[model samples]
Target: MSEAISYIWLGVLAVFEAPALFSLAGIGIPAPLVMLLCGLLTGIAVGATPGLAGPMAMAVSLPILISVFGVSADALLPVFAFLIGIMKGATVGGAVPAILFNTPGTPDAFMTTLDGHPMTLRGTPERALKIAHFSSVSGDTVSDIVLFVCAPFLAVMVESVLDLPEKTALIILSLSFIAAVMGASVAKGLISVSLGMVSAYVATGQGFHPRLTMGVEALSDGFPLIAAVLGVLILGEVFKSIFDMWRGIRRKRAEDHNADLAPDGLRPGDIRRILPHIGRSSLIGCMVGALPGVGSTLAATLGHSLGKRRHETRKGPTDKSFGEGIPEGIAATEAANSAVSGANLIPVLSLGIPGNAAAVFLILAADSIGGFNPGPSVFNFAAPEINPELVVAFGIFTLMALGNLLNWTIGGIFMRSMGVMARVPNRILLPVVLLVTLTAIYVQETSLAALWVAIGFGVLGFFFRVLEISVLPFVIAFILAGSLENTARQAFSASGGDPFFLFRSPVACGMLAAAVILVVLLARKK
Candidate 1:
């Protein structure tokens, strides 16, 4: 405890001191870059081990993180707050490649290709990248503030006397929200979610002890979250691309259109144009992020769609030209996606459940190393041992803030110069990514079986992509499956199997009421 407190104090001093160092005139270095490098170095060190992942890094570093400078939960709060900023910044930083070279650094940046790529075709790739970075940063910062203010008040209400049944009901409500908010059709969303639930059950050893292992000893340990995510989202995308290539969907052009690039910098007017949509996109992003299964892709798509819809409805006849390489599309998508980074952390920090795939990996890593669980108890019990939870949180926030500032300050310049990155042959990139993933997984358990499972899931992920199903639901379901089951068991035991115990608590009853209201509203809309 003493050690944790000391680290907290140290972190606080750094927080105040960092800005002063960053503000030194003509230093030409941005604060966020420093934070990103710190996070990256930390991530590489912790993530470098075979079995280690992000959460594990946090857990393992907990003792040192706490002891180094008298860190404690309260003291670390600013650090975590700073991470919110870092995540937001990083999300935007990804857009640089997406616009300049049609390569999306992050999955969520895929939508930026629609108009951003076109802007590149029209010789404004740098401008498009700049707009994306600035708009994304603006949206993320604004959304973080909103979440910081609202999460506590929301937690207060949620913490009030809730029993097991009500909590289950609330989970149901969250699922329903996902169904309503996801994809083009309710039917498709339902199907995607159902598949995810099934996958979660299979991976978690349900029904029988050591379930679905097929006599493989390694399978008894269950699936690795990171491997699963890589398989489903990243590897899956890769497979889909391969399939597309097999079917002759590959682009044949080789020449760089803007070979002699003269990129434009973002003007003050550009920032002003995107400011109005930032709040709306950020709110949407946060709400989606807080809900499990809904990721940044959906958030960006929904934000853009809504913005387009609103514009079309307002313009009527003039709306025909609405979505053609417009800045609004960039603003809406970036804001929505960036906002998700912070909102997603809410459930991870407060509930111990991961809202998306990356978070799920982080959670598993944390459990393996920190000896901490990712739920409400973490804040109370683990805060002593890892008292620097707040510091870590603040660290994340600082990382995000610095990340964004760096992206805004140098993203355009770097993107313009780094256009060659996009031209790299996919043949090389794909294999390298696969090799890294395999090496990472092998280091964790040294099990060949795990590698096979990852490959299998990679194939499965590809199929899902082809079917146009959302992979986020599967990730969310996987993270929550155990919690839902455990909570149900406890509720049943407490109620002596009466089932009424769920409704007995005021908090539970209120949750039930809210669920009912949401269901009614969804039904009415349908």
Candidate 2:
């Protein structure tokens, strides 16, 4: 109880102190720099092991999270919040490399290449990256502020009157939103979600887990989140590319002889050009990020589409047209993608529901060590044990600010240096990545089985990428399936299996209505 109270106080302090910290930095040291250092240390340590990714870090830290902070629910809030904030900032900071060197430092920054590459071609790569970084940071910061302000109110309403049935309905509603907003086709997205649910059920129930096992018995506990992510996002991609090369589907390009091809820094005019679309893109990103399944790529696409639509609808000849190499497209995409970083945390932090694969891993990590559960009850139940809010706020603020600082100070240098990494033979890098993944998984559970599971997922992930199916849905659904099932079962048991009992509460009814509406709208779109 004392620990929980201390956590809550810490959360309050972090919340109030974030803005002050921002102000103090007023062009002194960049926030992104600090975030980069922290994240770099964290990532290197986590990434060095094959099976330990961001989620695993969180999981491994759970013992410390619970013991050091105490097991109260609220105590975990601040830590989770801080993680979210850091993720938000880091997601944006990653684009610096993606824009400058065509090497996406993070998975979420992939889409930045579309416009970012073009700017690099125009000899303004630094300017483009800077703009992207600024827009992303701006969007994320704004969205976090929004989440901080709104989540409590939403939680209040959810906690005060929501019964079991109402809660179940809300979960369904959230799921529907996820399916509808994600992927090009709602059917495909829903199918992906269904696949994830089935996989989770099979893994948990049948005991033949989807991504666990390395053909060894020791890893039977199941695959660690870290291993799965590294395989899917990093190692898998590298292997796939190598395979393609082997098949002659891809060939090495001749080294660029022209030194002039290198990117020049951004111009002052570039910043001014992107300013107009900042607000719109940020809003789009925040909304999309708050929903599950819809990730940074979609957020970027949506922001671009909205910007184009707005630009087209304007009557007179405007100085800024969106499509023809205009900075607004870059701005909108950057802001939207960045905004997702923070907003994605809303569900993960407030409820145990993970909106994306990364959050799903985080949830797994939290669950592994008997820490806080994800849900509305987390705030109330854990409040006395751990202050999740404070941890979340502090971590986020630190990471976001640090990430941005890193972007401003060394982002360009990093991008320039990344060319060396890209030049490194894939043969060496792939094996290294694989080795790291294997080692990480082995340490997590002392099991070789987990390593095999990661390999299996890597192959599956490669196939999914080739097939053009949305992997996000499957990942999100898999994470949420257990909670959804448990909650529904509880609600049903409480209501004596009477379906109508779920509709008795106004909140439940409203959520159901919304779900229906969402389905109808999606059907119409189809």
Candidate No. with top lDDT:
2
Candidate 2 Cα errors over 4 Å, as ranges = 1-9, 12-36, 40-90, 101-111, 203-243, 248-266, 309-326, 381-431, 497-500
lDDT at 185, model 1: 52
| TM-scores vs. true structure, each candidate | 0.73, 0.73
**Ten-residue stretch with the least lDDT total in model 2:** 251-260
What TM-score does model 2 achieve against the real structure?
Answer: 0.73
lDDT of each: 0.58, 0.59
Model 2, position 12, has a per-residue lDDT of 45
- Tens digits of per-residue lDDT for model 1 on 1-526? 6553555455445454444225447663433344354443444222212122333333223333233323333323333322332333345456665676665655567677666766677677667877776677676666566645554345444545445676676665566556555554555556766666666666364355776667767666677665665667656766676677568774432234433254555655767666766667888888888886567887888888887776666655653333456566788888888788667767666655567645665565454445344554433323335444444443444454555555456543543454554555555655565676666666664678767877888887887777776666665665566667777778888788875877776766776677567546665565
- Candidate 2, residues 300-336, lDDT tens digits: the string is 8788888778767862675535533346667887788
In TM-score terms, candidate 1 sits at 0.73
